[model samples]
Target: MLQSLSIRDIVLIEALDLDFGAGLSVLTGETGAGKSILLDSMGLALGNRADSGLVRQGMEKAQVTATFDAPDPASKLAVYLADNDIEIEPGEPLIIKRSVKADGGSRAFINDQPCSAALLREAGNRLIEIHGQHDDRGLINPRGHRALLDTYAGSDPAKVRQAFEGWQSAKVALEQAIADQEAAEQDREFLEHSVAELSKFAPQPGEEQELALERATMMKGEKLTGDLEAIRAAFDGSNGGLASLRAAARRLDRIGEDHPLLAEALGALDRAVIEAGEAEELLNKAADALMFDPQRLDDMETRLFELRALARKHRVEPETLAKLLTDMETRLAAISDGGRSLKTLEAGLAEAKSSYIAAAEMLRLKRQKAAKALDKAVAGELKPLKLDAARFETLIEPLDELRWGGNGMDRIEFLISTNPGAPLAPLGKIASGGELSRFILALKVALAEEGGAGTIIFDEVDRGVGGAVAAAIGERLAKLSKAAQLLVVTHSPQVASKGDAHFLINKSIAGTVSRTDVAALDGEGRRQEIARMLSGADVTDEARAQADRLLEGV
Candidate 1:
């Protein structure tokens, strides 16, 4: 509930601070007592458009601060605050302040933290709702009627929203699949030809490096084979070093018995012959290794060139050609099996849509039932507000499929007919200003205890009614206050009498300046004020008695 409102330099209100509490609080005074100014200041704090004229004469700026009790942890307002990263403790106050410059510009703050006017308005909306004779926003907006009805019915839209998300997800998947299938069909021939070519060539990883090394070796061998043969001839026959070393070894062996030095020389010669023979064997192996077919080099060169050309065509390294082939084949397989996948996606989409429709249909039935109950409740409130001939209806119309949403497939509107046989129309269209105020009251009364702001302010809801009608309006306001706080600005004594707290607005002229002030009424003060309301600037004994009786009734 709204805890307090402090206004400074706002029009005639130079400096005024008002504390409010839970229950119906009434503000009453004579005409031009700055009641409208009070409401304007509150509106400014709630992020309404600022006017330079609202700043008091000779003042640099005007500021208004409105404080509200902390919202329930699970309430929408608390959720909004959390989502905006505004931290508030469990028992903390929600303070919204707005300052208007003389130049028509303004700034907003919540909990003394700077914020945009839009954010201030959003936060303000969750804390308080102001309804006036000409109000067309807030609950009056038809766009919010469906949500309001849902709240009244205690229907949860979460199931519908979840179903809607599922349906949309399925739809998107199916659409993407269809697009992929269409694109693949257009490139079917190219895919088939590429896959067949890659399959036949059968490129392997590292094959390019091996082929390049073999080609180079073969080219070098073609140039060096003759030189290799000349080297082999030197190691081949009896004239070679191996045969010569063996003849020397045999001659040395015959002389070895004649001297110790000669025996040592023979042993060394034999070791030399063995080493020379091993060298000849290695040379023969080299000559054989140098031999290769000329046509084999041609085949290897052709293969290397083909691999390079294919690599350039596919925009990949030659080593990755094998992986690329596997990928292309996979795509081709998808195209071949696309029909089955598409069918599965389509079926899933259908099921999702069916679930959404079922959820929406169930919500629609709940709304219909809620609408009837609401219409009957409003009808009961109409007669006592002096609109006995008025007919209220909660019109539930079906929306087209394209317009359907998480709110379900229904468009709900609050329609009314002011007179018998008159066509039911929008409240703004068919009802007069006073009648509209009463209609709003009736609707509000019927919606008592339904979800709404913690505090609701009404400006002269009983403006065109008196006696029993005013009393009835006051009764309903009191009843509403049981569920939420209410602040009413009224001229009706009957309505004022019903307030748990009553305030009187007074205008005074001091020197050349006009000022407006509010005074909380005590028992005698309230009686005198009520008497004044009854007698119009006079406080007669009979009026006092009537005021006493009215007070007693409460």
Candidate 2:
């Protein structure tokens, strides 16, 4: 609830501070007493449009501040503040301030932290609702009717929202699957051809490197074959080293043991002959090993070149060709079975849509039931407000499938007929300004504790009515105060007597200056104010007695 309001340099109000309490508080005064100025100052604090003319004549700027008790921690307003990174402490007050310059520029703040006027407006909306003859926001707007109806019905929208989201998700998945299948069909021939080519090549890991090395070794061995043959001839002919060594050794053996020197020489010649023969045999074996058919070299070159060509075609090194083949084969398999998967996805989407429809239907039923009850309740209030012939209706219209939303498939609006035998039309189209205010009040009274702002202010809600009608309005306002704080601006003495607190707005003029002041009324002061309201400028004893009776009646 609003705790206090302060104003400075705003039109006729030049520096005023007023504290508010819970329940119904009444503000009363004669015409031109600055009661409208007080409400304008509040509108400024609540982020209403700023005008340079609202500033006092001699002041450069006008400012207003409103303080409210902290709302529930789990409330939407609290969550919105947290989302915007505005931190508020527990049990601390929520202070909103606005300043408008003479140039029509304005600045806004919440809890002393600068914020945009839009943010201030959003926060203010959750804290208080101002209802007047010309007001078009809140309950009067058709866009908000469904939420209000849902609140009154105590219907939770979470199930419908969840089902709707699931349906959307399923639809998206099915669409993506269809697109993928179409694309795969276009690439089917290419995938099949590539897979077959890779399968036939049968490329092996490291095959290219191994073939290159073997070819090189064979070429080097071919170059060394001539040298190996020449070495073999030196050891093989009759006059070669091996033959000469063998002949010398035989002569030495014939004169064996004649002298120690001859014996040593013969032994060395025989070893030389044996070693030369062994060397010739090893040389022949290496020459034979180096021999290779020319066609074998051609085959190796052909294989290596083919492998390189395939690697370049696929934009991969030869070693990775094997893995690429496996991937392409898997894609081919998916393409072959795409029809089955697409059918599965379609079925899932159908199931999700069915679930959403069921949930929406249940929600619509709940709203319809609540609407009937609401109409009856509002009907009960109409007669007391002097609109007995008027009829209230909750119109529930179904939306097209293309326009369906998370809130459900229905559009709800409040309709009314102010005269008997007249067709029902929208509330705004059918009701006069005074009638509209009373209709809104009746609707509000019917709504009761279901939904509303933390504080509700009605500007002259008792306008154009008197006697029992005025008393009936007061009775309902008092009843509303039990659930939320209420402030009424009225001239009705009965309404004034119903307030938990009373404030008197008065205008004073001194020389060239005129100022407005607000004073809280006590026991005698309240009685005097009520008597003044009853008897105009002059307060009569009879009016005082009536005021006494009115006060006692409460």
Candidate 3:
């Protein structure tokens, strides 16, 4: 419920602060008393559009703030505030403020944190709904009619919505699978041919690298083999260099003991001869190990080239050919099994769609039942509001095809015929402004609890009606207040008298500035105000007595 509203420099409102209470509160005054200005200031605080003209003549800017007291802090609006990074002060009212500058710049804030006007509007929508005489006619909108029906039904339409979403997902998957299978079927023969060719090739992992390494080894040693053979022949020949070195070493060792100095020289020569013999033997073994057949090298090179050419033809790296082979094999397997999978998916999709249809049908039936009850309830309200002969009906038209996530394929609208024997039409098309206002009030009274908590502001909904009809409207507004806060701006004394709290909006001039002043009235003050409404700028004793009676009844 709206707790308070503060306005500064907004048009005729120079500086004003008004506190609101729960239950029905009505604002009343004569024409040109700034009633509209008060409403506009409230609208601005509720995130309505702003204009530079709204600023007072001497002021640089205009600001309006609205505060609400939520019964539950975890309400939808509270959650939205948290999601938008707005601070939530503990035990404090939810404050929304809007400011417009003389230069046309505008800013909005939620809990003192700056926010976009769009965000403020969204938040305000959750907190309050202001319906004027012209605005209350929206109850006839087809889009809103279905929602009212569902709310009346008290069923979770979310179940049907979820089923629809699941059905859509299944359909999309089935379609994609069918498309893939069809494309695969078109290339069935080509896929078969490729599978057969690649199977014969049988590309092995790391085979290319192994073949290249073998070819390299064989090619590098092929010419070296002849030179190694020549070296081996020289070392193994009888009386070759090794044999001569051995004989020289023996001769040197035998004479070494004859003389001390000469012995040292002979020892060193024998060591050198022995080392030369060992070198020759090592060279002979190395040469034998290096030998390879030229034909083997040519064969290895041919096999490596074959692998490289296959890699190029397949448009893959030599190493990646193996993975390509595996992928092709998997594709072939899928092609072989695709027909069976397609059948399974088709059956699953059919089952999901069937479930959705069943749920939707059930929901549609429930909505139909709910619609009848709502029509009867609203019709009962019309008589007291002076539409005793009018007929209200709920028209439920089921669409030909089911729309996923919609309200169960039913396009529900409220239809009304204002006079007896009149042709029924869409409520908005048939009902006059006054009739629409009453209709909306009837619906609001019918669905009072289901619409959630918020301050409901009825802006002159009693327009074009008077006497008992206006009194009935006031009664219903008072009844609505039991569930949520109710605020009415009205010219009717009947409605004004029913208010738990009364405010008078009047224009005043102070120091060459025109300002709108709102004052909460009590006792005699409220009686005088109601009497003024009853007598139009004059308060008579009879009107005051009538106001007192109305207040007592309320």
Q: Estimate every model's Cα lDDT from 0 to 1.
A: 0.89, 0.90, 0.81
Assess candidate 1 and give its TM-score to the true structure.
Answer: 0.92
- RMSD of every prediction: 2.8, 5.5, 3.5
lDDT of 1: 0.89
Q: List the residue pairs that clash in candidate 3.
A: 12-516
In candidate 2, which residue ranges exceed 4 Å CA deviation?
202-323
Which ten-residue region of model 1 has the weakest summed lDDT? 284-293
Error of 2 at 178 (Å): 0.6
Error of 2 at 42 (Å): 1.9
What does candidate 3's lDDT look like per residue over 468-519, in tens digits? Answer: 8899999999898998899898999889888899999887777976667889
Rate residue 215 of model 2 by lDDT. 85
TM-score of each: 0.92, 0.84, 0.89
Worst 10 residues of 2 by lDDT: 284-293
lDDT of 1 at 49: 83
Clashes of each: 0, 0, 1
Which window of 10 residues has the lowest lDDT sum in candidate 3?
132-141
